[model samples]
Target: MDTSTGPDTVIVGAGVAGLTAAWNLHKAGQAVTVVDPEPGMGASRAAAGMIAAVSEVMYQHTTMRTLMTTSAAMYPPLVAELTDLLGHDVGFRDTPTLDISAHPGDRDYFSALAEVQRAAGMTVERITTRQARSLEPALSPTISGAFLVSGDHQINPRRLVPSLIEALETSAAAGGPPFILLRRRAVEVLRAGEDATGAVTGVRLDDGTVITAGTTLLCPGVSLATVGGLPEADCVKLRPVHGDILRARLRPGRPPLLERTVRGMVDGRPVYLVPRTDGEIVIGATEREDSFDGVVLEGAYQLLRDAQVLVPGAADLELTEILARARPGTPDDLPYIGRLDGVDGLVISTGYSRHGILLAPLGGHLAAGLVLGTAPTEQDAGILAATDPRRTADPAVVDSASRDPSNGHRTPRERTAP
Candidate 1:
């Protein structure tokens, strides 16, 4: 844990967010250290990597959709940058997404939503089910309506993770080093001062070694709560929402199983199927709230049953792999990012629900810009303002009261545990 070169910034978790932040920090001439228990096996690996903003829009809110659309647009440039940095193609593909409906009610709802999105200046085109099937022969004839969103696309999240890792490794390989990828667990944040209210100095490892830094970035997916600095209520409130998906190996003579990211409402539930250039058909996602472990459940099996109604041939295909991973979801289905007040130098960028992969570039850029002294651009500023940790701060606590609860409040530490 003792190194001659002290890190300017310490980033926790090697998921997309952490890696992206490390990349930005390194580019900005800041000495960064990225610490994570696992490299490529976090939530980023479990993501389908569908960058569908319009197709995946919420029924009520457009804020997330707006952020997603902007992030989706930024992916091409980001992917190009990563590809150039990594010296390899990371499977950044520009493929439109289709949101189709099997039932009349779902089709009607989609038709209305399409109009709403179009009126809002989004590029959405309505197509008949037959026309949808014409674009991709695997689509079920039972599909009543579909909307083609031209701005949406997909990338290989699995490939992106390793590619970023390689880029980091390459930068390390060269003598010009900024961050060291410490493949170890971060047990807790070390707080300085009498009230334990000063800036986060570093993290303690399970092996009893301490690595200190000026700034600590917590990008650990579901494990963000395990860090000791955060309030027990805030920490314990963060739970995992498990999603199970199936990757089908393609056979010869079968033209792609899915042309683009095909999302549909089957039995009043949402299902998305993404096709990769390597002839892999990815059919996803059963969102179950109660599951903590990453074991595939019966609900995931039922997902396939529902998906086959949209694409009947899916059942006939060989199941390459069944992926079950837990997504870090906040109660309100939004991400928690930005600097916390109590802990001076600790920043969190977790609880990204399901759009973590699609939103990585912008999220990383904003988080990195914040950690460094560099002023964020107007775009980054807007996003950072929305996700600022101060938003989660208790408004009742004023000035010095907000800095540290342990000294201000006489409540025993035992009463604070959830």
Candidate 2:
């Protein structure tokens, strides 16, 4: 590792949230050094990449709804800026999303969910199955209900991560404060005073290299508690909520199966199909808080079986990949994205869970603003408060459960819309 020591900020993870924050800081003329063993190979790579603010709303997550919608609105400008800088598309698609239900029970569930979405000021319109089929001819005719959410969109996280890396590298090459990506695991965060009053000086890598900076941002995802030298790390309460996702490509000469993203409720379980321009469709995901780190047979079978029910053409597609990754889940299902208490120059920006891709821009902006000493607007201030890392709560009260001793994994947790 280079012994240089003037990076304004040091980021510990290079996932979407970390990379996005690095890009924002770099664009603002701040030198950034990102430390990660493998950048973008974590949960960000496995995400289905749906910008589903409108379709992902739940019954009681009002704070999450506000964060999602706000971040959804920020995507266009961020994409445009990234495209202008890179001189190419980063795989952001403004296509609408269709919410459909297969069974009568599923229809009833969505009908109630629509009320919650509407109450949060989201645009959702009920459409007949005929109308849905008219828009997407390949949809199964047996679908009992449909709703059009034109506000929801999709992006390719695979592309977004590379673009951010390229932008950061380009900036570094342009002769300013250097942007460094240290290919090493951060072992500890170096602090300058007592545990209760210390300020973050930099991070100590696994090999004992210290990269000093003015501020240190922790985005280590599920490994937050394992990072040494942070006294309050365990208090953040992060758990691994694993999910299995799949990718399939349309066979040659086959027309596109879906024009946009299609999310559905099949037998009361949520599943989604997101289409890309290059004849690929992403199907996902089965959420479980299990200890199994690899793709499960039952989870993969369920995704494939349920996807075909919504779009029967899914059965004909060629299965290309199957992956399993754990999202960093919080007790309340909201991310921790603010300054750490009693630690100066240290920002905590992990625990995004399933919404990491959807909330990247907002998380990046807030994290960078915190480093730059920029005051958030009134609207953003409320979101910052809701996501404050120091907020006190009992982690055991949530819907998640401990790992089962009989089985290798825990019980299936409640599923949320993708």
Candidate 3:
């Protein structure tokens, strides 16, 4: 096998988390090489990209609340920097999110959740259905109740991913540390020694070529377990949580279907409609753990049916695409981000589950800090502790329902849409 060495860091995935970390490390003058068979086509491409901090709150995941809110606060500056560098918009919207319920039970569910949100210092305002319809005339007048989260926003991952790749390319062209993209799957992680105590050297690609670097950051999402040479693989305990997402477009000259994102609980199932600056509306999603990886017909039907309940205009929008991808979920729903216990020169940032897009900035920041030996702030220190790779490894404490803590009644296949 051919071996080469020069890159300071090797990132094993090109999704939002890996790309964001790559960008941060490149800006810090680190020679970064990103490895992925297809860049930005994994969960990042399938995400609806709702940066909802307040609206995404759960009952007991307080650490997630802190991480989500902190990351949401970081988006404006990140988007502005990317726009300045690329000289164009990256599809970030400051539009507020509207939370609505289609049934009395749904309303009660959210009311209790809203109380929890307020207790956590989040902004959730109870608004009348009439007021919600006033904000977006397309809203169904029959909605049971509504709440507005002004701090919640969105960014189109489809646009943001390409922007990040372009920024990385521009940095490479500017003659700093070279940015390399390897369109190949990493089959094995190379290490300095044979035992678990050894430091990570780099990775061996499927093509029989090994690329060595000082640090290796694994952001392979759900495929983390498949990669070899990791002592902490079992301890990470990443499971594939699949979700079905749909995309639709407004008819010609139809005006916008809705100005802001609308999340609704229809018959106890959660769904959301996220609008783009363009005339496209993203509707999704269904969380499932079945063996089938493709889009489920029932999930699509449920999303479309519930979408129409929130906005009748949704019935007229032409369906554009339906996609399904598996997100890496942890036992406790919090992501695993930090160095491995006995492995040196290796860092992992995966298991983001449904909030990958919302958590990318924080994940990237934390992963880059770990690589550069930069000390995290006191707040970040606590967050790091919460996301430790070895925290929830014990099988006795693993609970599938831990993914959604707001409602214990929710099945393993149901998740609150952010």
Relative to the true structure, how large is the alpha-carbon lDDT of every model? 0.74, 0.86, 0.88
Which 10-residue window in model 2 sums to the lowest lDDT? 401-410
Give lDDT tens digits, candidate 2, residues 1-418: 5354769999999999999999989989899999999999999989989999888776556677788889988999999988988899999999899999999988988888889788877789999999999999999999999999999999999999999999889878978567999889998888886643488889889877888999999998998876788886666888899999999999999888899799998998889999999988999999888878999999999999999999998999999999999899876677888876678889989999999999999999998988888889998898888788876344542333232221111123235554
Predicted structure 2: lDDT: 0.86
Q: If both were scored by TM-score, which would come out higher, candidate 1 or candidate 2?
A: 2
| Predicted candidate 3 versus true structure: per-residue lDDT over 1-418, tens digit per residue | 6878669999999999999999999989999999999999999999999999888887666677888999988899889899998899998999999999998989988899899899998889999999999999999889999999999999999999989999999879978779999999999898776554478889999988889999999999999977998866678888889999999998987888899999899888899999998899999999888857899999999999999987898999999999999999877788989977778889999999989999999999999999999989998998998888877666654553354453122334335533
Question: Which candidate should be chosen as best, given lDDT against the real structure?
Answer: 3
The model with the greater lDDT, 1 or 2, is 2
TM-scores across all candidates?
A: 0.88, 0.93, 0.95
Alpha carbon lDDT of residue 264, candidate 2? 92
**TM accuracy, model 3:** 0.95
As a whole number from 0 to 100, the lDDT of residue 140 in candidate 1 is: 88
For residues 1-418, what per-residue lDDT tens digits would candidate 1 score against the true structure?
5433358888889989898888878877778888887886878888888887776654444456666777777788878887887778897889788887878977866777777677667889887777888998898887888888878888888898888877777776775456688888888887888876677888887666687888888898888767775562263235687888888867777666787788877656677788888888788887767775765568677668877888888877778888788888754455667776556777788877678898888778878877875687786677666566565455443234324432211122211110
* Pick by TM-score: 2 or 3, better one: 3
The residue ranges of model 3 lying beyond 4 angstroms of the native Cα positions read 1-3, 194-197, 396-418
